[model samples]
Structure formats: structure tokens, C-alpha cells
Target: MSEALVAAETPGTGIEPVPGVSGARQFWRRLRAQRAALVAAAVVALLILVALGAPLLTAIEGQDPTTYHPSLIDSARGGVPIGSFGGIGGHHWLGVEPQTGRDLFARLVYGARVSLGVAFAATVIQLLVGVVMGIASALGSGWVDQLLSRITDIFVAMPLMIMALALLAIVPSSFPRPVLVTLVIGFIAWGNIAKIVRAQTLTLKGLDYVSAARLSGWGTWRIARRELLPGLAAPIITYAAILMPVNISIEAALSFLGVGVKPPTPSWGQMLTAADVWYQAAPQYLLLPAGSLFVTVLALTVLGDGVRTALDPRAASRLSIGTGRKREAKAAKGETEAGKSASAVGKAATEAGNGTTEAGKEGSA
Candidate 1:
């Protein structure tokens, strides 16, 4: 088929394809059409930047996460901040913590680092373990496949919270809390992805190219790498994007429960733990971390949904906003066309009326 024909046929494929344009460019164009996704992506990017630049940001404000400003808090009033909005003022940006009087803004920015970093690191680990185990289960001999499948089933059956608590409790405090949390979340949470990968790999394993690679005496690893990996990339990426936010929430929950990150390290969840009692007295302290967590999770979720739709445009059915916008655009176009036609008809009718009036006057003359 000609390139023009191929390009013309692609609009029905959910990606607008221009002649000579690569698939990646087409995918990007489709993604850009999702406004919510774009905004969410921007939010996520800003968060990452904030997390990365936390130290500099704190330094610029001449504040650190651990500093105490005793004067900012009212010792007489049960450690409540003296000023309004958690003692927000010139020296304190987001305000000082209730009792310790630590810079809330500084701790918030620093907390972003722990929360984002642990989630990101854990996701990477999960992706690696899931993909490897999934591929292995698919390509292995019958007994090996059975063994791996059973192992995956066991992991899936284990209660995540119980396992996490048990593991976190037994681990020594000498170990870095952030690293421990990441490892716990990553190692325990990969079962779902592994199951997904196994099913996908099995489907791909039966494809003609994969069989041909095997027929050519290629090793299992080589066949998987050369024939199956490309086919698996899209689903893997979509799942991984969706998985990160879940990991983030899990980390936060663990920290809030007092088994995640320790104090002075600055985690959103840990901050929330401390702020629970101060909710009535210092709502800003609670609201700050709570709001941050809510926004982060929401943005990540939207971004993940966008990625899934971008990778497989058929999934755009789930994005009501995108479909709604398309509907509105079509309606607007119809209205515009209708108005233009109505105006043209009116113009023609007025001209005809003028002609008739002129003919009657000529007859009278």
C-alpha cells in the first residue's frame, strides 16, 4: 500500500498519522490531545523538580527541616502555634510545626524527596522482578512454569499489610528507614505485575516470529529478547505507570502507621502521623501534607491513565474528558455550519425582496 493510503487509514486507528511520520510522533500527538493528562504530567514534573531541588529551596529560604524556633509556638497554649495559620510569617513560610517549631515548608520540600524517591526506586525494582519472573514462567519447561506460577500465587495470596508490618518490625533500626521501606514495598508488591507479564508472555510465545526464533535454535533468552520483548513493552509500560502511584500511597500508609520512615527524615506519611493530633489546633500542618499526598496521587493516576490510552488508543474509552471534548468540538462545528447556512439564505432572500421592490417601482414609473 502507498504511504498516503496508510496515513489516510490511520485516523480510525486512534492515532492521527501523517505521511512519513513515525509511530512515536503519532503517539505523542494523541497524548497531547488529552488535556487532563498533560496537566497531570506537568504537575508530576513540577513535583519531581521540587523534590530534586529541596536542599537548594530550603537553603534559599534560610531554613532547614530540623531547626527549632521556640518563640514561634505558644508553650502556654499546649504547644499550639502562636500566630494564625500555623505561625505562617516572614521567617516561616508554610509555618512552624506545633511544638518543635521546625520549618513546615522546609520539611515539606524535603519530605517530597523521601516520598518520591522511595516510590520511584521501589517501582523500578518491581518492574525488574516482575518482568523477569513473568518471562521465566512463560518460557520455562512445564514443571518450571508450574513452580514459578505456584510461587507467584503464594505471593499474591499473602496479605500485604501483615507482611509489611512483620518485615518492618523485625528489621533493625540501624538500617536506613527509607531504603528499608523501598525494599519492602518493591519486593512484596511485584506479584500482580508478574502475573500480568506471564499471561502476556504466553500469548506472545505462540506468535509466528517467536516460534521461528525457537526453530532457528535460538536460546530461550535470545528468543525472548529478540522476538517477544518488543511486543511486551506497551502493556508493561502502561502497567508500570499505573503501579508507581499505588506504590507511593502504600509507602505513605506505612509511614503513617509508624513503621515506614522515622522522624527527622521527613516523609509525607510521617508528617501526617505527627499532624494527626494537631488537626484541630494546627490544621495547616495536617492540611499541607494531606493536600500534597492527595494531589500527588491524583496527578500520578491521571498521568498513568493518559499513558495507557496513548500506548493503546482503544483504552481512550475510559477517558470521559477526552471523549467529551471531542463531542463538544463536533457540536460546535455543526453549530457554526448551521449559522453560516442560515445567514447565506437570509442574504439571498433580502436580495430577492429588493429585486421585487425595484420591479414594482419600474412598473409604476
Candidate 2:
């Protein structure tokens, strides 16, 4: 068929074809395709479960993380006897602390709770504040952007550790010092997230749909919320996933420095601090909490990478390799159609030539 005929016969829908997949579903599909993501998610989930089931996992009674068994402590050596995690049993599963003889298993489980809780809470705080400030900056006018940008820059440049130390120095020694640390860290860390979200929002606000929404008489709040917010979800969620491990590490560090969750309330950092002195006598004491922290951080880091990859359209294309759209099929179909068309045209011309030649021959005869 002629090009014009093909055009006439083709389906009409002037609008660009939207991809058949919803972003969230596509992201999930991509994540499910990745082995690393599944492994990381499983590890993270296990840690969360251990944290939540802290009490049930450990034997109740004198095994409280804070309750010390001086009898079990080797006073002469200033540490507890060497014990392997593989030897866990009735009284002590993971082992016992070096100097205090507190059940290591109980402390480890309880510590997970404190560390994960603070990290999650702090991340939520930072995410909310960052998203709000970011959207505000994008939706606002010249001076507003300038003011928010300047504020963001100031925080971005500030030293996080020094600021944390200064703030925590005045914080009263309390059972749940994790709360104060979380709030403070979240407040300080929001600036970077705001900057990221603001950049994304600025780009999104200029998109065609945003302008169309505004022209349709939508209010600023409605435009910001309905038009631009959804576009920001992927990056925000990915960044938040990465940031949770950071928050956990920071809380742990603060606890080690003696300004985080106070004594009696176990935290990974505090356990590390307490175990540091008896490393020579019982290496397991130091290694246990440190290993947990390392594993948790590693899992979160992997999960963040997976989430980012899954959410990214370009990255998803790579992961979806053999299972996605069949462009080769479309190419083959085109070639087949072209080959059939060429054969038909050639046959028609040959027949027409034969008919004319026969007519000429008849006239001569």
C-alpha cells in the first residue's frame, strides 16, 4: 500500500501512548526481579522482627540488659569467660558481657529496638520537614526561594558531629535520650533533603501537566499537591531508605560517645562502648554488637540501591531485559509486511506487462 493509504488505515489517537504500567507497580515488579533487593529486604525485615520481639526472644528475669551478674564476672581478670555464640543455651544464648556479665543476647535484641526505633522516627521527621520545605520553595516566588535556599545552604555546610555534640551536651541524662538525638538529627539533616526535593520540584513544576493544571484554575496548594507531589515520590522514598541507615549509625555513634540513650536502655552504640574495654578477654562481646550494626547498615544500603534502581525507568529497562517489551517482534513484523508488499507489487507489474504484450501480439496477428 502507498504511504498515504497506510496513514489513512492506521489507528488514530493523537495523544502519545502512555506506558501501560503504573509507576508503583512497575517499581515493585523491578524490585521483585532483583535478587539483591530481596535478600536485603529479608535481612532488614529480620532485624525489625528481632527488634520488635526483643522481650520474647530473650529469657525474662535477671537477664535484663541492665541487671549485672557480678558472680559470672571474672573479677581477677576484669572480664567474663570466653563464650561462643554457637554455645547459646538456657541462661545465656549469645553470651555475657565482659565486665558486667549481662546477657549479651538480651542486650543485642533490646539494642536493635532502640537503634531502629530512633532511626525510623528520625527519618520520618526529616522526610516530612524536607518535603514540605522543598515543595514550599518550588511553589513560592523569588524571595521565598532565596530565603529557603540560603537556609538550606547554611545547614548543608554545618558540621553534623560538632552540632550534635553541642546539642546533646545540654540534654539531660534520661532513659530515652534516643528521642532527643533523633529530633535533633532530623532537624539538622532536613536541609539536604529539602535541597534535593526542591530541585526535583522545580523541574516538575515546569512540566506540561503542571501548567495545564494551573491554567485550569487550580490553587497553588492543589497544583503543588496534585500535580507535582507524585513525581517526587520515587526520589524521596529512595533517599529516605538510604537515610535510615545513616540515622541508625548516627544514633549509635552518639550512644557510644555517652550522649545517646542513657544507661539501662541498651543501644548498639552503647554496647560497643561498654564492650570496648574487655576485647582482650572476650572478643565476642565487642564483635557481636559491631557485627549487628555492620549487617544492618549493609542491608539498608543495599535496599536503598535496589529501591533507587527499581524506581528509575532507565535502570528498570536494564533489569527487565528478556521479559519486557518485544521490540524484535515489531521489527520482524515490519520486515515481513515489507517483503509481502514488494512481492505483490512485482507480481502485479509482471502480469500487467504480460497482458499488454499479449494484446500487442493479438493486434499484429
Q: Assess each prediction's global lDDT (C-alpha) against the native.
A: 0.87, 0.79
Q: For model 2, how does the per-residue alpha-carbon lDDT over 242-262 read when each residue is reduced to its tens digit?
A: 899999999999989988877
Clashing pairs for model 2 are: none
What candidate 2 gets wrong by more than 4 Å, as runs, is: 1-19, 59-62, 82-88, 315-365
What is candidate 2's TM-score against the reference? 0.79
lDDT of 1 by residue, 26-118 (tens): 667767988889999999999999999999998888999998889888999989988888888887888899999999999999999999999
| Worst ten in a row by lDDT for model 2 | 1-10
Top TM-score hit: 1
Clashes of each: 0, 0
Per-model RMSD to reference = 7.1, 8.7
The true-versus-predicted C-alpha distance at residue 56 of model 1, in Å, is 0.4
Collision pairs in model 1: none
Q: Which stretches of candidate 1 lie over 4 Å from their true place?
A: 1-19, 321-365
Per-prediction TM-score = 0.85, 0.79
